[model samples]
Target: MKSKNSLIPLIFSLIFFHSAEAICKPRGFDYIQPSSNASTSTSQQQQSPSPSAPAPNQVPSSPPSTSTPISNANSNPPSSEPQPPSSSSSSPAKTFTPSPAPPPTSSSRPLAGINLFNQPTPKTEPTTVDPAVKKICDSTDYPTLCLASLTPFLIVGKTDPVSILELAIKASTQQAKLALEAATKLASAPNLPPRKASGLSDCQYMFNDALDNLESAMDAIPSKDYGTVNSMLSAVITDSETCEDGFTGQSPLAEFDDKLRMMGSNCLAISSLISPII
Candidate 1:
């Protein structure tokens, strides 16, 4: 019995030594634990129902039980930072220009004076009178005697108004005297009536008066005595009218009235130059 007990203790000692050797063996990990307590704690944490595998909301406090410790890894340099493209400002808008205006044109024609309507004018020329008759008839002397001789007798029995005949005779006698006086003053040839025969003497005398009045009127014109000239002409016209009336009906009255016609003819002749008197 003593030997068997001793052998049983020795066997127990050998089993214990082998087990210690296996538990204490080194691994590839750099870290090593002094006792099994850290391993046991990890194993118990992993196997103790693992807190029902912790819901997604559960928190864990312990560090990881890794076979090797964690180490930081080298990182690649950051890619060159791309700069945002710079925004450019807009340029100013363009300006515009305008064109000039044109001027007005002028007319070719100028304004001037011109008579559009053309017409005719009469010829201005002097007319001739019998100088001998004009010289004697224009006088103013013996006006009453010369006026008495002329008569109108266009009708066979008609007689002129004695008063009108007297006025004509008075005017002619004075004209006759004036003519003789004018002739003497001008030193011109005297135009006197020749003494007539019988019943024709008064007619000749009146004719002589007509001649002197006309001459006297012409002479008066140079003296600017237009009134005297005009008066003489008026007297002569009156005398002729009286002669035409008084001799209209008498025999030889034609010859008597002819003297008055001569007086009017003389006035018309002078009127050519004296026409402006009208």
Candidate 2:
């Protein structure tokens, strides 16, 4: 019985060994190798990109960031295009028109304070005479004498009627002054006869009257009093004629006679010219 109990313990020991042997045995190569290869492949799949994914060398494409700026620039293209034209249209200064200049007017009056007597007589004949001068001269009793006397004054372009009358009165006064000087010289002559001295003294009185009348006529011209001018000029003519008549019956003071006759005739012509105006 003791020996049987010892065998029984050995049998339990053998059974435990066999079970350990079975539990401790290595796995098959196929199973371990296939599992290792599958694990390696799974790690490679996780580490590397798929074929459909982008390459490492290529950059990833997303919606273009430049599109927003490009769209904003294009949004107001028409608005920017019409700004220059609107600014140009608002300015009307480019279409300004200029005004026309006024026409010049002609003057009828003579230059003031011109002295006809001091002015030199023109050597050459004028191409034309004023119609007003011709009309005034023609109205005189001695048109030829009036025209000839006034031609020297009119040639200077002083065409005013008042200036013409002033010139005539000045000429008449000058003649009277010359006649008075001649009479005074004859009256003062040594060894003078009574009859000759009497005629010369009468001539002096008549010349004084003529000078006074001519001066009065000159003063009347500025007043536009042609009637008074006519009366004074008529008196001048009468005084000159009376002076010439005083020398007539005597030896005829030839120089004094000529001057008195010329003075009387000029005064008569000037009076006729003023008659129509009066």
Which candidate wins on TM-score?
Answer: 2
Show pairs that collide, candidate 2: none
Each model's lDDT comes to 0.43, 0.63
Residues 1-278, candidate 1: write the lDDT tens digits: 99999999999999998789768666764434446667855655555556646435445555445576445567555569886556685656878766665543323322121111111111231243233322322432322222223222122332222222223334344434433333233233255323212223444445466666667766665565656666776666665444345332452434334334444433333332243443
Could you estimate the TM-score for every candidate? 0.24, 0.46
lDDT of 2 by residue, 1-278 (tens): 99999999999999998898777656762323237648955555445475356446544444324533346654654464444455546656566578886654324334332321232222343456578777765655555555555665564667556666676677667656766776786688799878777788888898898888888888877776767777887777677667666654543445544444554566556555555766
Worst 10 residues of 1 by lDDT: 113-122
TM-score between model 2 and native:
0.46
